[model samples]
Target: MKFLFDIFPVILFFLTFKLYDIFIATAVAIVAAIAQIGWLWLRKQQIEKMMWINLAIIVVLGGATLLAQDETFIKWKPTVLYWLIASVLLVSSLVFRKNLIKLMLEKQIVLPVAVWDKLNLSWTVFFLLMGAVNLYVAFSFSVDIWVTFKLFGATGMMLVFIILQVMVLGKHLKPMPERIQTVNEQDNLIEKIDNKAGKK
Candidate 1:
């Protein structure tokens, strides 16, 4: 559900492009991006940093496409966004000495420090490659093909990458220890049992 929501604008853009043209699709994408943020704000949802980044990029590049009457701006949108994300991940880990991925997932899962670093680097590299791929498709293929690739090919690749990441991470995931009662907790439990028996 969340994944669909994240790609809402892309889906709308692809459909609009098929029904109309690139210009119309760009306008729809811009509107969709704005609407997405507005809806989240109205619902009092915590808007993620990445959502804001995406919205900003779409508005800027999409607006350029509309105002200048050129599809080039819109075509560059995905590449720019992907590179920005990759840069953030790389800079945060290397210069800031902080792993954003680890920070986000550490509460839910535990892994060795080395594993965390590798995971972060892997994502950084993947985004870089995705950005390059977007450029290749956008310039080498027709607009129709690029739009289709944007909607399906890019999404499919992302899913495949994530599945592979999960498979690799599974080997390193630490098994959760079984819960054990402390001595004090055991004493409390026994006292409660005795009290219940006395009442009976």
Candidate 2:
């Protein structure tokens, strides 16, 4: 699945850390990220901007972590990526007068402008909060705990957030015309019954 491909680097990083150490895991992550991007290129697939950003961060931060033999740089990678995404959402919404979330999802969903704006803002805030949370866990915990947080905490939070977003979107979804007409007719009949009861 595409989801598995996107997260292949992180998965490798976690497994490597479990087997060896942070430096080796960081090195593995760097290689995996580059390989992922190269594979996409060879397939002639259009890489998403987020994927490019991820590769850049992995190479730069992960490389620094390996070269300096410091786990700090690699630890910051997720926070950096999260903040970058937050910035993109904020800038696109405020500066460009566009909702990046809506732009990404418009083909798959249809909702009112207000609903789109709400979705965009919600995601922006979520990313920002996640960035801060990553830092807190990375610093406040042991390397092993931090690594677990990196893989499970971050992924779990995003999955939960997405499920919640889907629930919200369901509430704002535009009903089909037939469903709308049926609802309207039911409302009219109910109103008629209420009037007849009141008169009697």
The candidate that achieves the highest TM-score relative to the unseen native structure: 1
Model 2 alpha-carbon drift over 4 Å, by segment: 175-200
Model 1 lDDT tens row, 165-197 = 999999898744332346567889999999999
State every prediction's TM-score relative to the real structure.
0.89, 0.86
RMSD of 2: 7.3
Tell me the whole-model lDDT of each prediction, alpha carbons only: 0.93, 0.90
Q: Tens digits of per-residue lDDT for model 2 on 35-122?
A: 9989989999998988889989988988888788888998899989989998999999999999988888886677999999988889
Error of 1 at 116 (Å): 0.5
Worst 10 residues of 2 by lDDT: 171-180
Clashing pairs in 1: none
lDDT of 1 at 41: 97
